[model samples]
Target: MRIDRRQLLTTLSVTAAFGGLIPVIGQAAGSRDPRLIVIVLRGALDGLTAVPPIGDPDYASLRGDLAVDKAAALPLNDLFGLHPSLVNLARQYHAGQATILHACASPYRDRSHFDGQDVLESGYSVPGHTESGWLNRFLETLPAEQKVGSKGLGIGSTTPLIMRGPADVLGWAPSTLRAADPDLAPRLMDLYTKSDPALASLLDEAIKTGKIASGQTPITAMGGAGDPKTMVAMAEGTARLLTAADGPRVAALAFEGWDTHAREAQRLTQLLTGFDNALGAFETTLGPVWNQTAILVVTEFGRTAAVNGTQGTDHGTATMAFLTGGAVKGGRVIADWPGLKAAQLYQGRDLTPTTDLRAVAKGLMAELYDTSSSALARRVFPDSAGVAPMRGLIV
Candidate 1:
């Protein structure tokens, strides 16, 4: 029995690392045709370490071996410094293209990664809304004229909950696998068109997506999810897709392996370095579009302020959110600056969050999409009416 080559290729694409990243095109709504990308760093990132408060009187002693020395870190301001591994971010910060929201968190308070991520993605006051994500919900609220050809881009084999919803979304992922025979796609597409029109449409879409996914830097060269290089490769591919003249305005990507239960320092060095490089790739790849782009990097929760016995920090509350891209009003670390003193910590353990992350997301949507406060409150992030959208985040 001969197997259909098209089916086999589809199977292979799904099995590959760059399986679900899908790019969608949209018509310009008005003069502002802005772009937004949300990168969810799974495995809660350690905020205190990522952006250390070196000037705080109690930071060094509390962190001990886990502490980032002042000399090693890239100074963000007199009070806080970025992890030394983040060279690209440091460069961007100085160029006024990067902004850090320190001591920020979603409404979720528990430390469980699953629950934390659900709240972070679901845009709910609590967890368990797996049917859709806030970004998808926001897409639903767009005016019909603006959404005519618009679709959300979900980057991964399984679409992250944050991009899953009633709105149409395209999925793709980055892979090192060789492309299928060029002739095979056209022939199979013809066969499907003649007999099964539905299947043909699906194949046509897949072919276009596969073509976009093929030429980007292979994921293998960058290492796995744990390797920082992977982040750069992913960002490069994402940039390529978004820069396409008819490409998507909104994209969602998720990077894993940030849990860091042990060996936090060594691991973070590689991860942050890759993360920093990826940001540079976006700036370079997007060109003038960078001026209209806002990249939001966030995590589930944070880690404890004090280092644990395992040379790492345990899950806690309040980490940080990163907003970078030329579209952002950047170069500042926005924090209410909750001190690192034991008494200052939340429940005597983690950084006490002063800013709700929802406000940050809401703010960007409000400005970029011209989404109203009432709509954002009633629809995009239901039950979040009390949490006003943050302003002055975008240029």
Candidate 2:
């Protein structure tokens, strides 16, 4: 007499079933239809290795064996170079479509991954306050009419906290199984329509999003969400959805498996390669829309300045954030250049953060949505009104 949610899902899988389906309406575009994407790279990224400061005298000595050879790295300028595995990013940089923000971090100073990510995505000065995320809050600040449509999108098995809040958001993840019967979806919809209108309404939206996601590679096909191999597939699917006429204007995605406490050289290579390919997918699939979009790639924190006993770096402070896409004022590395010398290091172990990650995020939001500084400080970032948004980031 009673039906379980899992059973309903299993039966629906015969046609097309989704992980998490939420109703999200679409909005009419104004004169300037700007798109923004936030890609959170989970696990600490070694900022020193990813964007090696080859020009810094202490860089080579401090990094030692983990040092990125300047000759092999893609030169960004006279001082900094991107890791060799970032081939596509390097190309984007050279084409004047990429910019790097070095020595950056969230307000949180502790090293707990769980807490650090919470603070980073939650857009708060401290961790443990997870009722809503900054991006979702930003969506709440949009004009009331904009809320009628697809304002915020979450792509993955579940919505990341960064995209969770009072605002409605569309959720999409490619189906992992083949449809057993093409007719099953409609049949179930009819049954739900008669027996339960609530479920039927949800099913309708699911079917709609499923159609939007049709022809995309499943997460399993690409080796799961956290697997490096899945990056391109995930990115391509995201582009497909974003390119849709009625798709969301802003989106959030998270990639995992970046905590490299050991075997970093080999691991980092694979990760960076996957990331490079994903960047290529976004640039290629977005077409003309790419010119109006900006992608922000960030991590929870950076790793230690020196390599550990296991040839990897430990958790520390101050990492790098990437700003890429045609909308960005590219070909620049923004940093206060905290030297790696012991005296300059944070706690004498990690790179010192000079730029607030929130400032960069706020600046982007300010430009893209024309959000006022007071609104950003009050509703989006919350507290710390003294922090000014970094300028010259957007074209």
Candidate 3:
């Protein structure tokens, strides 16, 4: 009954269900009606390889086996180029629907995946300081009667901690989601029912909420969640829901399997391919709404700059973040471009982070939701008073 954090996530990753949505019955339109999606690539992503700085003198030397050939890359301006796996993203860049944020990191500096994700999603300067997520808090700050509804959604097998809080959230994952252990659920519940009542109660609530989500509207999203093979289906299903005028207006999703400490060249290719395909599905499935939406793709952290003995990158600091969709002011690679020199690296190994991701996120939040800077700092991202929201990200 006392499940470890890792075990709990492993279990939830398989058994996905839903909770009720506070119906947005008459989805009124306005500047605030714009769509925004936050995609958290759970595992660390190699910023150098994904958006190579072909112009940097040290890039090729540091990357070695993992270096992408600029000749086959998709040109993004004269310096950075998109990885070949990012074919769809390349086309998006050309169409002015994409922007990449380089050398970015959350406040968390260590290489622990769990802690890094904790700070990234929780919106705190340090990990483990807060229990609720920033997104959930942002939802809580909405004017009680203004526009609260199913517009807030989390799509995956289990909702990311970022989407868990007071907000009335709707969940979507593949209906075929199976349990990690057929008897695990019952056994856990029984153990909880007798000993840890609080934990047991939460499990009960999730189950009941899942049932409440049944029969209202079909889980039309093809892929459901979590399974990599169904990535496109997940994107299509997300778009299907977002397109419904009365359905969700803002959503967040998480994709896994990015921890590429070995066979990175081949591993990253498949991951990027899924990412590209998902982007295409969003454009195709959302139809006209695609123009009004901006998708934010981020990872917990970036891998090391130098390739290891295994020809893969290890955990490091500073990576890339992406913003794409019709709402974005695209055709730009925004980065101070911290040099790859030994002195330039953070602690002499990873890329030194030059941008605080909170600023970029605050900027987009203000543009789409018109949430004030004061409120953004005080409510949405507490203790982040000095980190000003960025400008010119959305038009």
Candidate 4:
């Protein structure tokens, strides 16, 4: 009973926090007042499915069962089409508030979700290269005069490693955390192990679970750590906090469950809906500050181009990047157009990455915050001198 009650409380806290009840404290926006939101899709998102390359002669054939039906895809251009689930994003694109960056990826190419996410967030050419996040370092680059002497407010339980550099960063999560007691974790884990064995095994994972399983319902049913409503509400809270004239100007959000190893068609469709809705919520909540904002959506890596036997995809390479907000130079599917033929595949299985994600980041930071590419390579993204910022990312 103790375990069950604890689990219930845990879920309740998430409900309350995500429902916009908690006010997260963060670094006040600097003098520039430019807001940047980085939403990390932890699981390997299949770029092909999210932003389908229908015009590529090999796309449909290579994708097999995992391919999004071009006829149903929302037309983005003569070449690419977005999945129906991303209706909000497509609308933003039409309004010139979004841009689709195809065949983009971080330097990490391995399939491990942990490592991929680390590389994606850490902004390193290799994993474990930095103790801090690129965003944190980006914040460090801001003129001391504009910094406003603030730290970041992470939206989840433990502060993520990327945000852990020299700069101070605070964290916020759904919790009933009373006065900090050293024995809390151990006691909770002990109780959880004795009560709910399944939930106990993933104590850390529990902190991020979108929904708790009951009865015969599988835990796998929850799309990511966040459910659609929770994600939307989280966005609402973010907008509220960020829109504050004195609120933190930068934030980091992570959403998982892109690992569609099976039944990807069904799974991805649902996840995409969540993604679309979250973006919509941000737009609605940001209000006047929307014009000064730039939201960058990126994934660790993309899934294979070819569908597996179970109508899903394996971890591959090269996916799409999404940017939306009033500050972005939108209505363009930016790419070097790597053909999806077998010979063109990264390893003869994945889409070939044509652009570096760091370059995109460089462009945004340089353009929005008046950051320079030289400084971006030197300070923000260490050893990223050769990779030039993809120009024209910001208006």
Candidate 5:
């Protein structure tokens, strides 16, 4: 049942022959659906901080001094409240353009962030040896012709392992350089291939598209600045690229600095602000195509339900995943109802996860690419047959 490198590549080719690649071109005479964007928030965002529980009887006591005032929280519903810093997303939610999945996490139960991320991205129950991510696997399932053009894109200094696979892929990092140096691109490609075969193949594809050697100015030069702002600008750039006629179909964007172990208020606010801006950029840039796109914002897991002695939260269980875009069936918080009671908490420390994050991901993949849950479980997220893909996530 284990997939090796070569077999994995072959599987991609076969999958591409059937499943359609994303970032699909112009709306067909009868076709309307288009693209999907995935944003991964690293460092395990504290869902309780981002979206507080204003209705939970024990919420204030559990969060202690770190709890945000009801006045400061943007009311999503009478029960669930959003951090004031997420005004942008809050507006989207109120407008029926965003939805939240609460008390959710990857099947992995261990506390290691690295392993948790691996399980989250690799779409596997266990870590240490997943070869491809569920997104890439979804790409593989697309029709061969649909798979044509640039492969998946990774934004940031390093390509996430989630987006790495046999499929042609590309990497873009916002830099201060005015433009890509024609000579430097091929040299860099050579270096990558020599150092890492996987990255080499990816770079080769990027170069062939003339995207790498186009001498295009760095995205940062186009007004991108600062930590979270820079990240949002990166996402804006990604949305622009994905919407292009000749641009990539699938893309992966990662935002760091969500680990709020201390100074939860200030740090979480900044992180959520950055996320809000990034999402706003995507919505604004996508324009009319926005309705055709679906953006899934997810994290490795949630932090402890109760604030710790450090004035922040620690890695624990459960969390929230956001689905936004024109295509999302929004204006609702999706969950299996795991309460925040002390006895209800996982290990009596974290919010007990009631919904499997994989189901949400699978639901999106199924709707966007016409892939089935069976394939998702068998090839994309192995041993997840017990987890059915949730429906009604797409408009």
Candidate 6:
């Protein structure tokens, strides 16, 4: 399907209007204390591969060929082990700067990326109805003055659905090596507004800020040129912008290419290495502000608990959500302990979800923004009053 930028903006405008009703919560007035960054890992992430359970008695048996041995995996704790390629993240975990939420997922149980992302970002109980993201709703809830013009920023070629909300939003991608003619921006904006008012507004804002709407080669560029290494480069660039003095307080980014249908080991290793480098970049660039920043890395869902015929995993349930930053209460794996035994698996195929991903997100919002749990559940994530915000996720 073709991606329509204007249609997306119009939807966001409508959502923004309704989001204003959400009650303000979190962060006291005049507190520029914390920054929040969310990285969306599109396509299902194989949590079993990232954070292997080397100590689980049945893990090796269940995973069989996909199982990673303790000798090869990077040890995170006595019970959990990380992929060897994720050495940077493992170091952070040891330094008390990272934590993993294993067997966590959105309330949705389906396999569609669109629906899963909708539930994850919209904060609504159901999919498609949530026009705005929980983050935008949180921004709307803030007292009027604290709501800056651009409270949200999106990185990459096209903005992810999560950051598309009514709040003032800014988008930035690295400048293309070949610059466009100076007049091209204004001309494009004029054409867009005349043809589509909603798209016009978005393009106008982007143009006014001297940001390009397109042209930069995304890390996903093919031919191996836009592989994991390029992805890390993009992350570093995004981190630099987020940490800037006048930059946005919150941002969202998405990285694709995690769908490992075959040759899982080689592909997963390279991807994890890229992920590790990206985390290192954020830690380095954020510098002092890194202490106050919290980064939540999540995916739409998890892969199957058991390997498929192709030696790959299928769309399943209960993936891992990674939390890192100076503010995180780190060095621990948070889970309610759903064992990997055959009968313990959800639907007899995937790991059963013990923690709602939203709870972790709610906790981050509450801690970083000082928002109240009540508001987070009721307003940010509608009809989510029962899913209390997790505690001690951030220091």
The ten-residue window of minimal lDDT in model 6 covers 15-24
Q: Quantify all predictions' global Cα lDDT against the true fold.
A: 0.82, 0.81, 0.77, 0.74, 0.73, 0.74
Instruction: Please give the clash total of every predicted structure, in order.
Output: 10, 4, 5, 3, 11, 9
lDDT of 1 by residue, 1-395 (tens): 12364444445443333222344445345887788999999999999999999899899999999999999989989999999988888888898888999999999999999999999999888989888999999988888767645678777656788998888776666654554454766787789899978776666666566455545323443355545666766677677677776667888988899998899999898788778888898899888999999999999999999888889889999999999999898999999988988888999999999999999999999888888999999988999989999999988
lDDT of 5 by residue, 134-156 (tens): 77776776655455443777665
| Per-model TM values vs. the true structure | 0.92, 0.91, 0.83, 0.81, 0.84, 0.83
Runs of candidate 2 with Cα error greater than 4 angstroms are: 1-30, 145-151, 176-181, 216-220
Best by lDDT: 1
lDDT of 6 by residue, 9-41 (tens): 433321221111111122335655577888888
Model 2: colliding residue pairs? 25-149, 25-150, 26-149, 26-150
List residue ranges in candidate 3 displaced over 4 A: 1-22, 25-32, 148-151, 178-227
Q: Put down candidate 2 lDDT per residue, 1-395, tens digits, no spaces.
A: 23364335424431363323333333323556777899999998999999999999999999988999989989998889999999889888888899999999999888999999999999999988888899999888776654547447777777789998888666665555554365776797899899988778766766666565544323344455567667776677677667777667788898888999999999999888898898999999889989888999999999999999999999999999999989898988899998989999999999999999999999998887677899999999999698998877888
lDDT of 4 by residue, 215-245 (tens): 1121122233456755665576567667655
lDDT of 2: 0.81
* Model 5 Cα shift for residue 48 (angstroms): 0.6
Model 4: pairs clashing at backbone N, Cα or C within 3 Å: 27-248, 133-162, 210-225
Write the candidate numbers in order of decreasing lDDT: 1, 2, 3, 4, 6, 5
Tell me the TM-score of model 4: 0.81
Ten-residue segment with the worst summed lDDT in candidate 2? 19-28
